[model samples]
Target chain A: MSAKPIPGTPVFTGAYAMRGYALNKMCYSLNAAANRAAFLADEDGYCAQYGLTPPQRAAIAARNVAQLIEAGGNVYYLAKFAGIFGLNVQDLGAQQTGVSVDEFKAKLKAHAIHNDAVKAGRLANV
Target chain B: MSNIIGSVATSHIPAIGNAIHKGLQKDEYWQPFFDGFPPARAWLHAAKPDVAVVVYNDHGLNFFLDKMPTFAVGAAPVYTSEDEGWGIPTVPPVRGAPELSWAIIEQAVADEFDVTTCQEMLVDHACTVPLQLMWPEGWEGIRIVPIAINTVQHPLPSAKRCLAFGQSIGRAIRAFAQTLNVVVISTGGLSHQLEGERAGFLNPEFDDLCLNALINKPELLTRYSAHEIVELAGSQGAEILNWIVGRGILGGAAREVVRNYHIPISNTAAALQVLEPA
Candidate 1:
């Protein structure tokens, strides 16, 4: 059942959950508008309130999905944190890949051609 | 006696909720994906089901990492939607069927499934979006019993495990004393990742294989472990586990009524498939 890991795809494992619990809790709290506003009003205080680790705090400060992930933040939760600044999944993807928002979107849109191939039954079997 | 009429599976991407809210179904970017629902909708109209058993994952809305349940069932009289901190439009509260929920929970527990039962549950886009798409006028038309799977955490239930769980749920539904016609609806995945450098990743071939195997040879998919599925299908793409469970619930012979696949729906290979038992 073991398989080589996919590069750049960090599966949110137990270790990550254990490490990112605080960071994720903070992000999960943003589901409430009040919590989101509270975090916005005092970013540093919010992190402290959640007891974010130094690395987790740095990742949040960096606004880097990769770093946040490395610090144990799952994207589902991290997405709430991203929402604070109007960053969607594309923006997060672009940030993680070091590409512009347009470029990231283009990357996703380009899959349409591949989908057409599959629809046409021209795609090779897996 | 209660019976499963069929199963409908689709990608429950958050953007879809926004699109439906903004009346963007005809927008060029969304048309193709939105168009795929008509056939499935038509079939649903013809085969009216009284209740929907929705299988989906909670994206940090109902459960947090601290008390993450591998399998959870909604036992509330009603379920509400949350914005999930992203300002996505929330749908009206969907009615929940506690009797069916308790039946499935009792059966699952008796069968050693160890599923968590929630008296008060908040469903996320995964559960809400599909219901909205299926019943555009309103979700109030159908009562729902949501089965939330743990797809966010790494130690997710194996594909085989989800299949078995679905089968257990099917038995519970069929054995219910009430004469309820239920439809099993599941949301998530064809193949698109939204994490790390592989964000927006799509695998058309793998997606095609999954779509085909889901109908003909679902067991072929159980060979891939959860980690392996993440490697091949992307972290979020593993949401196909929901599909696997739906297919298992269908259990015996079934035919694919309709299927729609489109790429790049908010970082997902959006797919809609309807299957009816033979």
Candidate 2:
């Protein structure tokens, strides 16, 4: 590891929002057809079947989609939020699995898994 | 009877929750909206769940941008919310269900779900602070399963894919065959951008539409192309998939329990919902 510090001055203003082609492709291609129809039908039947009025269903539909869009898709944001739950992402896979960085990286690379920060660091370490 | 229950949908702007706990809600633009949650208090108290399987996104707390997992489940016995410089005041640590956690982890893995088994985790700002203000009372006798989704960056799982993940988890939980009644919680979203000049925003129409789909028609919500959702909601708003997974785990057709929507909570729409079993 190396360190470069400038006294009383900021050195770099780097910003990174987690994004990648693999993730975008996953989002673009993943589809749930039956699930969508089932959900729509359930909302409709609520009036006759469950006793919910149209306005109520409308409100619910509006709210449900809003909720899904707001919190459902982003991965980098999710990891950041999970941190609030006390699960810190230690870059080293040593927290619980007892796998050394080097060992974990080798295993992950051999398996062709490359999205892990720990594995990436370990590759550098190796 | 294997019945369908209610669902919760809320915006999880990390900064807003922290602001409320620190008493910054009033000092900032979040004051009026933060005050909106009082009415929903009664609903939360009445439908208090014994175990809350809180589904949320990890904001680089546990996993980093270097390498991220699509979905991770916490099978730990107990968890402590980590303080990410946005101090949480006098909140008790969250309790866990070691038994259920282990069982589900084993089941999911056996079912080929590449589950991450965490023995211990410092519950950070993302999970606890919002949960604290959201549920209060710390929910006694109620255990918690902290599940993480990959939502921060691009190239993440689609909303439909997350629902599939949710269904898998629901199957695993039902397989537990225990006497304990569980409450599945999906928290996050409704809209409010997180980056660039458009960061602090609230699309009420969009937010309402989302909540409706989550409570009355989750299946419909799931089919939304990720791009469409991002178009309707902000890009950062995609974290709602965590909540969708919870709804998916609970079998999609959730009854609405409570709904509260507020905007400008420090650049967040700050919506909250508590779904019940129908």
True contacts kept of 1: 0.75
State interface RMSD in Å for all models.
1.8, 22.8
Identify the CAPRI category of the predicted complex in candidate 2. incorrect
* Candidate 2 structure, TM-score to reference: 0.63
Write one digit per residue (lDDT tens) for candidate 2, span B1-278: 12223445555555655565666756644654566566555665565556667788765445544456677788787776543322234357778987777766776777677866677665555576556665665555567888888666545577888887777777767777565666676767766444322333345566666666665577767777655565556655676788788877887445665666654443345667766756
- Docking tier of model 1: it is medium
- TM-score, every prediction: 0.97, 0.63
Candidate 2, residue B59: how far the Cα is off, in Å: 1.4
Per prediction, fnat is 0.75, 0.04
Candidate 1 C-alpha error for residue B257, in Å = 1.0
Q: Against the unseen true structure, what C-alpha lDDT does each candidate score?
A: 0.89, 0.54
Q: What TM-score does each prediction get for chain A alone?
A: 0.90, 0.19
Q: What is the TM-score of chain B alone in each candidate?
A: 0.98, 0.85
